[model samples]
Target: MCDKNCSFDLSKRHLLKLSAGAVAFAAVGGLPSVSYAASLTKEERDAMTPDQVIKSLLDGNQRFIKGEGVEHDYLAQQRTSQQGQYPSAVILSCIDSRAPAEIVLDAGIGELFNSRVAGNVSNSDILGSMEFATAVAGAKVIMVMGHTKCGAVQGAIANVEMGNLTSLLDKIKSAVGKTKFDGERTPENYAFVDAVAKTNVQLTLDEIRKNSETIRDLETKGTIKLVGVMYDISNGKVELL
Candidate 1:
């Protein structure tokens, strides 16, 4: 019913139509149809509530623990975030090299605003940063994260003094005293050290609210949530406190 040339032309036309349809689908989806990958937009970030943001972080940590991290095209994410950032949370964490917040939480670039200090303690400057992150940058959650076996906690317990470090360790001393540990209340006891670390995170959370009325008002108004967490370096696990 059809000549060879006519049949070949019909097949070619059909293939072209299919290709066009695929392109149309990809365009509507905002990336190649085969792969959909992009950074969080302001609209997307705004759609999530503080609770949802926290849940997402918890889920991300679970994935990290399972070794099932989301495949991220870091280069693509970096390129997309240049326009603007819409981070969902601001994290205050220690400057320990092993306790990187992003890696532990499985957060991608532009997903969080991280402020790192030695003991994860809060000060006027840190409070100012939190205010800006929540009020100005639209972050919905503020997390004060501490880790187990923290050297800063050890320093506070041992009363180690070295130049400017002496003054910095003073801030953490309050937490060391506040921690109600019965046995071996010293850095030599790992349990006591970790207990102090947890207490420090709680103290930092309290200090943030006490120091920053802007952050306090935001939390009171239900615009943001403030929470604390502890990271265990022995096993990549984050415990919400």
Candidate 2:
């Protein structure tokens, strides 16, 4: 080897320039370079299969559980979805701050059309919203999620009451009555509270299936799938129901 001794040899520099030029040439010709989306739009994500869609959501939840959540592009996403949204999932979850749909599911913009209320009940307005999500907006899946140690569920178990909150708590009473725990019916009984939570999610899912004609038709046609989930606040694993 000739001793160029850490100096930039002209021929070697020229070859380096040639290599870079060839790389630029190939990139310009689009020879399998990455096609990144600066932001996801409704039309851009249109080609995903059903299994792919579910896997995407599950991956996001994995990230969330590990606290490796991605940075937000919410304003950019809001602008992109201003025209329309083809959300992949319709989520019915509790309104607990810790159980926010995006954070819990680790979904990005335009991923889920979320509908949350106490007990995740399927009232008329919620059913209407879900109908729109599945029928009008073309969501692929509907998830009804209940959380552990839910205050509403506890209130229902003990018959707790307030002015307007009474009615809200009353909605959950059905779950309490439905839950057949051999022990006491007090909030102190963790088993009782947990049972009611699961029962409420199941009951809410049943109500959605029975009441919403749009969802029923979609389910019958195999156009959409409905499932229930339970979020454990202590340990972030979402148990699929």
Clashing pairs in 1: none
**For candidate 2, which ten residues in a row score worst on lDDT?**
8-17
Report the Cα lDDT for candidate 2.
0.71
- Among these predicted structures, which one has the highest TM-score? 1
89-153 per-residue lDDT for model 2 (tens digits): 78989898878877877665666889888777778999999898888877767888899998889
Cα misplacement distance, residue 71 of candidate 1 (Å): 1.1
Model 1, poorest ten-residue lDDT window?
7-16
Give the Å error, residue 88, model 2. 0.7
After superposition, the stretches of candidate 1 with alpha carbons farther than 4 Å from their true spots are 1-36
The parts of candidate 2 lying over 4 Å away from their true place are 1-39, 43-45, 49-51
TM-score of 2: 0.78
